[model samples]
Target: MQINKRHQVSPYLVFFIIYNSQVGVGILGFQRTIAAKAGYDAWIGVIIAGSFVQVFIWMMYKLLAKADGDIVDVHSKMLGNLLGSVPSFVIMIYYWLASVSVILSFIEIIQVWMFPTLPSWILCSLILGLVYYCVSGGFRVVVGVSFLSFIIPQLLFIVLYLYPLKSAHFSNLLPILNHSYKELFDAVKSSMYTIAGTETLLMFYPFIREVKSSKKFAHLGVLFTTILYTISAIISFTFYSESQLKETIWPELSLTKVIRLSY
Candidate 1:
């Protein structure tokens, strides 16, 4: 499983990968979770949580850069062979769980919105096949597909953003900081899950061709992703009532339904 150093990705591709990976499967449910915690001011909570995640991204980069090893090697170096291997195993297990959960979530979305009669296993198999193709192509191809994914969804968002804007209620974002400090902290902690993929840098550093610029590109990727996530959250909260948002399965797609093309 030796990674070739010849296929270094540019900062922009790194940005695309971070944004695409972070945005998937979670954006649909994030509004409900944030609304539950911060009420009408959920966008504020999202912004704050995203900012904190940016910090975590930095910390992860620092840890990886300092260790100068892949994630498994870093852990083994830090915690000794036995203890480190235990935690590394747990992390890898969690990664597999997270990946499967994401794939299943996407299948569920397709079942509800696009293919009502399609079996979940069929959708899952299709997604797995695509994922296998990309993954087997190596990191460069995976990053390229990530860039394509990022572009298509963002273009869709641009179209969706232009609609009647009837659902937007700016007042829902007011009265910020009403929650207790502990409550706010808890909300932010939960929100961290949406911003978790930048930690991929740990596994990816060894594969990155430009090792010297890895931290720079990683930080840039995180910053760009955080901004996009915050903006998406703001748009979601602005357009939907707390109850409406909570009830909606995919708020962004729900928002898209309001768009009217001139045909």
Candidate 2:
């Protein structure tokens, strides 16, 4: 297959894709997972995890920029034809699993929250079709959709955060560093998976318009996403106890429920 060398995406679009892809699925459950280790100090765990992810993103970008090709080509070159295939296959499987999991989770969320009567398969099919349409348009369309997804959903967050403020108990975040350092490290490592999508940079570097500034964009994107994740984690920790967080499957959404819009 001949590779098409098309116009590259803007840095903002790159940021959108990285942020949206990472934020999906994981955001709903991130607080509970971190609370398991750091208790009410989960926000610190999120910050530590975000920093680790930024480092990984930097390393992946450096490797890709040095390779002079997309991830598959670079892997084959670095690891040789046979050994390289192993990592490539593993990555392919990971992407496939992640895609399916995201789709299923979206359906499950919609079924529970919005369309209680709808069958799971019906919701899944509708979502899968939309994903297929976006994916079929190739990388540019997917990036465009990602940009839209990141912006629109974010507006609701402002309302969600505001409602919880009056009732929030700042004392919930006290007694910081109460957990052992090892436990905090483990929480950071686990939450690092939430920011894992930046690894897509390995494939995207070849498509980035300003390849010279790709590193800057990648780091900037990670920094922006880390801030968002940290804020959400902090809010969830302050609003819910460690046990309450564990009991709530979707802490952010649970927080949103407290906000009643009279208009």
Highest TM-score scorer: 2
Residue-by-residue lDDT tens digits, candidate 2, 1-263: 12356746766577787788688878887788888877876678788877888788877767776777778888889899899989999988988887888888888888888999999888888888887898899888888888888889789778888888888888988887888888888788778877678777766677777666656766777888888888888888778877788899889878977877677
RMSD of 1: 2.2
Error of 2 at 180 (Å): 0.6
Which ten contiguous residues of candidate 2 have the minimum total lDDT? Answer: 1-10
Most lDDT-accurate candidate: 2
C-alpha lDDT values of all predictions: 0.74, 0.80
> TM-scores across all candidates?
0.90, 0.93
The root-mean-square deviation over C-alpha atoms between each candidate and the true structure, in angstroms, is 2.2, 1.9
Per-residue lDDT, model 1, residue 158, is 69
Tell me the lDDT of candidate 2: 0.80
In order of listing, the candidates' clash counts read 0, 0
- lDDT of prediction 1: 0.74
